[model samples]
Target: MANTPAIGYKFDDISEINTSKDAWAVVATPIRLWVVPSFSGKKLPYSMELVLMDAKGGKIHASVRQSLIYKFQPLMNEGRVYQISSFGVEESRGDFRTTGHGYKINFQFSTSVRLVKDLPINRSPYSFMPLSDVALNNPDSYYLIDVMGILTGYSEELEFEKDGKKNKKMTIEIEQDGVRMECAFFGNYVAEVLGQIAAGDKNNAVIVIQLAKIKPFRGKISLQNAYGSTRILFNPDVEGANSLRQRFLEAHEPAAQVLNHLPNSGKISVSDDFLKRHWGKTVEQIKNMRANLKPSQSFSIPLEHNRTIEHNKQNALLATGSWGMRAWILESEVCLRPPW
Candidate 1:
């Protein structure tokens, strides 16, 4: 008997696929995967979201929704190539689109997934965005972005009560070539980063975060971990980390030298000219006015009353400066520069 050769389904490039068809044949590498729990908090009703990259470096978003989620969840593994068919295609929606593709996949009851055991393509595509251009592309206000930078500074852990639960948070500031960005991590991430810093990891300066959400807080843009699917790498095996670290080292200065330039005194200066112009009086005249200020003389002893009035007068003199400037003076006691 003559042997018959089996025919494989024709696969379509992810970039070229759209919502025009009800079914598609897609063969792609799973670069990122996120499993979201159902709304009711049931285990069986969960869904999977993934970003798949094609051979030509094209990337698209695919998802396993509802009833068919359980069947395909176990089969799809990140960093593997699979030829999927009979899945529903629809227009990608929402403010946060993981991929730029106009269409995304929806796993149906008849969806078929077959993993390719033989490995040939090894590298996955990564579209890392620079910190400067983050504001331009992040206009939609909720897209997932990938960023890599050198760690410049971090803040102490903060504990806050939200919804009757105590949550821990930490903010890490990173810089790329001079541009700075801050990202806050909650819960386990706080511990994870603190541990890495404590261990004195050499690669602590180089950080790469994938599937991070862009958030604008108090007039500043912040990068935040998107939880489940998000991955954080310190000194990853990729060349990008090494390249950035080298650039940082070449331009880096000694820690003490950098710290010396920081402003240690009050930023606001009350000049003699400003006092004369605004208050119609000179600095010496103001000093005399404060010295002469007195409190109500009562049954209290004269010395005790004099002390109380002196204390109140000093407070009033301090109050002349703005609240923020007052706090700065108290902390560093940095003398204000005399504006001649």
Candidate 2:
């Protein structure tokens, strides 16, 4: 037997609630929650963002503004079902959208929340978009999406100044079906990825990034974290992750076996034939080759040429280990030397 609320309370479907309705209530579980930073650069958070899913599997984005945080923050809990009423409904317009619902819920001062224990609802509400589909998506689209794939490679943490404060960023490459996509994570997200890499085997690790924004650079598309809305999971114990791991291993077993036999040298070596062909190339020629170079590949340049490249494009040159091994790695920006 399931427990029910009072007879006067009628739960409305998430899809049915709109601004037209005078009173509405919904039984939904908060699947994802994050605190949005204040846009004004203040220390306090601007609002609490959430992705809620109803018993019918309908999802919606909800927000508790800063002013009302004290009142509602204590009552809300992630992964718990709640009966909510008296919330405001408004058009969901933003560069980063957590859900596809036409409208979003806003917690008003008069809003009510009650814990519900008997609702049968799906807890793992993930809608993963394929890597190939992400490449075809419009870069300027406002709707953010979820993605899951095998973690192939990642760049070293890069630090820079943003708004007079030091910030960190790291770029990672994920692959599926021979199609690879570059994803950049900033701030704490970079640490999260690094921590996961340190804790587990990096080879064939499954990664899931939720609500990532599509970005286009040069002629290719990539993914970037959408501020506080993005959620990252590394080798999570979920159905989607398990399925991806099995498929990737089955498809790439032969390739993996071949790679296992290859030398595990920390530095990549270039063939004499490749060096002979590219020797004495101008910096302009190297810039043109950026589009063709893979993230994992690196090429060497003479120490004399380093000064010329640095003088002309200082921002593009990320001085790495040493001048003796002037190996440049290609990413969104070229590095003067290999990270190793």
| Top TM-score model | 2
Clash counts for the predictions, in order: 0, 0
lDDT of each: 0.62, 0.71
The residue pairs found clashing in candidate 2 are none
What ranges in model 2 sit over 4 Å off? 1-4, 137-140, 253-340
Evaluated against the true structure, the overall lDDT of model 1 is 0.62
TM per candidate comes to 0.68, 0.72
Which pairs clash in model 1?
A: none
Runs with alpha carbons beyond 4 Å of true place in candidate 1: 1-8, 38-45, 135-139, 199-204, 256-340
Instruction: Report the poorest 10 consecutive residues by lDDT, candidate 2.
Output: 259-268
lDDT of 2 by residue, 93-154 (tens): 75577778889999999998888777657656787788888787543346778888888778
Top-lDDT structure, candidate number: 2
